[model samples]
Target chain A: MNQQVLIQAHQRIQPFIHNTPVLTSRLLDEIAGAHVYFKCENFQKMGAFKMRGASNAILSLTQEERQKGVVTHSSGNFAQAVALAANQLGVKSYIVMPKNAPQVKKDAVRAYGGEIIESESTPIDREEMADKIRIETGATFLHPSNQDEVIYGNATAAMELLQEHPDLDYLMAPVGGGGLIAGTALAAHYFGNNCKVIGGEPSQADDAFRSLQSGKIEFNDSVNTVADGLRTNLGDRNFPIIQQHVERIILVDEDEIIQAMKLIWERLKIIIEPSCAVPFAALIKERDNFKNKNIGIILSGGNVDVKNLPF
Target chain B: MNQQVLIQAHQRIQPFIHNTPVLTSRLLDEIAGAHVYFKCENFQKMGAFKMRGASNAILSLTQEERQKGVVTHSSGNFAQAVALAANQLGVKSYIVMPKNAPQVKKDAVRAYGGEIIESESTPIDREEMADKIRIETGATFLHPSNQDEVIYGNATAAMELLQEHPDLDYLMAPVGGGGLIAGTALAAHYFGNNCKVIGGEPSQADDAFRSLQSGKIEFNDSVNTVADGLRTNLGDRNFPIIQQHVERIILVDEDEIIQAMKLIWERLKIIIEPSCAVPFAALIKERDNFKNKNIGIILSGGNVDVKNLPF
Candidate 1:
């Protein structure tokens, strides 16, 4: 995908999404010795940046496909995103979920008007369930983070950030399913004026980090980080873009992630998910590299359970 | 005192304080049965609306007064507000705190460049200590929410909300020492098109509510609410304004406050103090009155201790 594709994705989803605000804190700036701008995607619809990709993918469907509906498999924010986006667009959405998924998540999907088809608690099972629904209903299947349109859609968040603050020295986003960071890397490449792109990943789930070092796709053995959203490995659609455009990926430990998450909550006074905090944690882990630089971090989402906070 | 006062206050504090973003949530609006706009003073400097008044009060001082710095007696956000306001203006601030004040608060005040003067943990002792410091250092003693300039400063938060959403049928703020509610009432009177101002008071600290009924100031026998920022009684200066301009006071209990606070944290995805939740609780308690009408609530602060959350 090119810059034109990113621009078109933004235009398509403009009415369906919020151009989330950029927040700053002097106390946090002093703590990190850098001027930091946080693009708060936590305030986005359904409380995550996943909404952008979901909205873009759904909006790009043919009129016939739209009438038939959309299908996706997700045990997380994507389920809510696709459901809500489809509902907003007046299209039907079917979400394939693992039976063991949290009741709250299931309730959220339903609340967003998504029809859930329960699958066994496995990736292969979820995909099979989604495929069955697509075939039965003549629906369009939307990959959460592994398609050109989804990655192009996610790029708009960073594009808006750059439009507002074009002089940022570094743009950072967590390395989740690679959609967000890949989009962010492309955003910095096309829209930014020599701004470098950095990826923040949990050490326990360091697929993106290893993939960049080895120059190919990599898999994780233990998907055991508190940043549950970032456990997924990079996809073929986004991995090549990340390799070519991403400046570097930094790995942060679980404790460091929790500590950084607490600081963002306390100092920024905004609720952000643990996955969202991974990049900010990485910046803090090796702050010497960012000292006095103008930095921007895309806070991926704010869907954490306050009752069960890691802190 | 008038529209001119609020206009000047906004201009004076514009450089020092943030014109904090007004946030909205479709979920909250649907739940509350009204179109609601949240004037988020929780995102204001010092993480509370107190900064608006503190900055206005500090800026309104004479050149001579500003030179000697400012003084206040508080065990909470006001102390930090005065400290930071003073520091921002490159002036020294002396805060009279109770000896038993939280160490974290004391640290926050000091970090904001405020000098601490410890006093016995009583209203009488704190006032006496503040008076002594004022006499000794010639610093202007700023009341937390009692004086005219401070109240006018507090009014600017609502003035801003009204400017952004002028068609709001009602503007609500939590009643504490009466500064915020009094100022809000005045703002609605001057800037709104017949917009009514509502005050939310804790049943445990129902002074403002009772004062309105009595047509004079009243005091609560007990101030046993989790909303610690709202325990103080109305002062003579702000009570008259409240009686004259405020439409009514709504009493919310502790449980309602905590429930609304949780909903805001979970749905709005922002950190707000318990005191900030009182007005929303009152709105939800009496949603029928606000059904389909445009409502605005000033979120008071975001200074709650996360570890000690009621929910």
Candidate 2:
């Protein structure tokens, strides 16, 4: 929870990332009995908040390091973010994605000039493939969540959120590998000590919640959730940081997340993927926790395959 | 044609309507051989550009008239827009919608506090039903189009586009009742005389194209486009304005529109209804016309039912 690191990340990523708007939802406010402000990172570059961290991490690399290229294992938003950022910086990107990853995401990575190496769905398999690519290409491996720079970069989203609404009583975000929530909590703690930071996790993949309860990192053998972004277990690096600043981790069922996704799409007219809907799900399912308070929720991404929307 | 009316409409609607960002695509830019700036009114309030017209028309009524409430005949965006606008203004809204309209839109209207009066699909039946409601409730009839105020309000979208990108070499927008195009053309003519204003229409409902060519209003017995928003024939008021400023009307087939809709959703991660895909259809199908030029296209709406996406 180093304040200077978050500040440095903010300064590093500010030029590349969009200062996405903080949208107020009158309907959500009424429903939650709180003034709900949505920090719309869903509208960020590469269509997700991952772009902030990816861009920051990519841009921070030295010219010599960049010439060697970068590698990462992501089957979703972070893959596209890293691909696009590396493309912008004129560096090659090697994306190690699951064999079952959506064609749309693979196509996006290719469109952004990232070379993809598909691997088995398991984390070990993907990491092994990424390691092979890194060793062969002499590229730096940028972990989606475990890296310090990535977490620091992800914190800028909360920096922007708190800067826009300083009096926010609660800050909530969806937790996957815990990069976003860990970064968000660190930034909020740095900016406002009194503000409670909450993590919204899918009930089907509630590793973060269980990990928090047990005071240890936890893993799920198989994740089953419509929110594809929250399937990953909290990383070792992110778990410790999150444990320090996060007030609580609330679990929302897949059905509730789907309902929240529809509510946001119908009312806000914003196309957010199920992952981004987790926080809204938490708010809707746990309204009493946020009642009469100024709450800020981060809409993490909008990269859902329209053809495969979980209606 | 009336500068003062346009100015007044711009002033009245400026505060309510979102000046949604013009998103550009590097990939599309290379493919189209031009810089394409998408004016995303799909992100506008009520998920459509209809909000500008509906909000301005509702707010323009005299306080006494507003006290009496407002009425409109629309089964689509206008129904939701008018309902939401009236609700915002604390005015009762009576919406005459076709019984066959999608439940999602009907739900949206209801959610916005509109009282739905179901009617037959025919324009005559809709108009009669709206009129009866207006007469019974003494409510001001806010025409979806074919009204001076509504057309003026629609023009503000183009005004904002021109202000944001003054050097736009070509402007294209979908033509339904010609409300958006008429307004856009008026703004383009005033702000960028050299700019070519093209109306994009569904080939199945090419009434606007036919009307522009024949110098008279035209009608289609049964529109057969998936673009529900562009099924209507050009309104009497809008047809004349469009005929004056529009350089050409490009007719896009339903399949092209669907493909464009998919491209926007998959590429840009924006949820746009089929009608809003017309301009992109024009770009994809008639790239030769806009190659290497600075083009501005309006994304008319994003209110499509997620379950009902043509894909």
Candidate 3:
């Protein structure tokens, strides 16, 4: 990735993305045996950090490009982010989501004025449908993660985190398609190498860990985890960035993540989805690894269907 | 109330309470025909603004008073706030809650290291039970709102809000025992009387409005609102303050409060309890009255059990 592009991403997305609060918790610090500062991307626009990348990608489009409209294949936060961002820019959004996607998420996408095209469950099917839609509508396809603009946009969170806490010894975030962590790593490296960047993945979907070990992008045949947000494999563009800047990848079990989620809700009174709890789970599972460190944890999202709480 | 005591309350609870984010929605603004700034006390410590009073009351206690422990009768946010604040201060807490209180709230009180003393449903029965416990254990009974210290603590949120936006044209908050609105009125008056302070009450439990109108405290025979936090009548100490400072009391139907709760959750992605949504309900119901005004609305709490959403 060009350094200029990342810098441009920071400048372009500055006005669009919220500089979300960095919250410190004495209770969380005691539990983690470290001073932990949470960069609350869960409180970001669209209720997730995905808005940073989606808004950046959408806004980066030329006037003519926006006139033709934009398309993406996502059933989750990115779908809502793209739709909302496009709506804000007065540009049409064509979203390809799986038929089985949560109704709440689908409703949110449509409410943001997106044109939804439902497809089969698989990513291949969603991508194929997106391609068909793009061909028919002459829309620009904006990949959720495997796009340079998206990675750069995701980096904004890390930039803000590091700017707030320059002496942060360790940085951790949950990994899904590796977009957020990959971008965070790039930003951490750009800011300073002293701040070690790590990715936390659910043990049920440990493709990121496997991919990092083998130094290649790995695909999961099937994924099952209560954390609906972290079920995807690393994307093509994000894998290399992760390899370059991420210190290590840790896997946390479903039980640990649920416990973390409950802890956040009960103690911190912050409602975060299971994916956002993965970093806290990683800390609890590997306490010795982060003891007494000045840690920065990115709470990825807060878009949970309250009715279906695992607890 | 002593002038010095009010000033001291301002100093004591100012740092602990989150000036709480003032969130504005273009959609809600358009709908209300006003620029609404939501003061999110729901994000306050213990997931309620009650923490401000609880923490202040606990902190204000003499060392000898604290050594005797603290007791309070509450089945809701006050119980949890007292427990959490006392636990933080390393003081023992004795919470008297009705046996039929929500298990989630009771459990939360227990989780915060509070010793629960179950009583009958009525306030008289709970108070009798609390007095018994207070005498037997030599615990200081921290009245939820019918006390000067607690009201002062609740005032800090308003103080901060006025400081942030000095030219706020109008201020609104839900009325439950009138403590929050009373404190808010005091703060607003101390800052400036140019800003109108309106109390929002559920039509099902409009005792505050009735009490203000009749020049005497009035109690509802039965309360029936989804806003569990706003069911109580005005307190002895708080009623006078409300009569003196509150400009108008607006009553919203239960359904309006529900709709407001859903709107906050769906549009803003913030989980607010029905009680907290009352002010927004007023905004929605009385849109014409507030049109073109710079409105400040206090979202008092977010402690609703997400697993059992009313919607």
Q: Supply DockQ values for each candidate.
A: 0.78, 0.55, 0.36
* Alpha-carbon lDDT of model 2: 0.87
RMSD of each candidate relative to the true structure: 1.2, 2.3, 3.1
* Native interface contacts retained, candidate 1: 0.67
Assess each prediction's global lDDT (C-alpha) against the native: 0.93, 0.87, 0.86
How many clashing pairs in candidate 1?
0
Off by more than 4 A, model 1: none
Model 3, A74-161: lDDT tens digits are 9889999999989988999999999998787788899889999999988789989999989998899998877878888998898888
Candidate 2: regions farther than 4 A off: A98-102, A118-121, B90-92, B99-104, B133-138
Q: After superposition, how far is residue B32 of candidate 1 from its true place, in Å?
A: 1.0
Top TM-score: which candidate number?
1
As for lDDT, the candidate ahead, 1 or 3, is 1
Q: How would you order the candidates by TM-score, starting with the best?
A: 1, 2, 3
Among all candidates shown, the one with the greatest DockQ:
1
> Candidate 1 chain B, which ten residues in sequence have the lowest lDDT sum?
B1-10
Which lDDT tens digits does candidate 1 get at residues A122-238?
Answer: 899999999999999999999989998899889999999999999999999999899999999999999999999999999999999999889889999788999999999899999
Model 3, which residues run further than 4 Å from truth?
A2-4, A62-64, A98-107, A117-122, A133-138, B1-5, B15-17, B58-70, B83-122, B132-140
TM-score of each: 0.98, 0.94, 0.90
Residues B253-287 of candidate 3: C-alpha lDDT, one tens digit per residue: 98898888877875565678899888889888988
TM-score of 1: 0.98
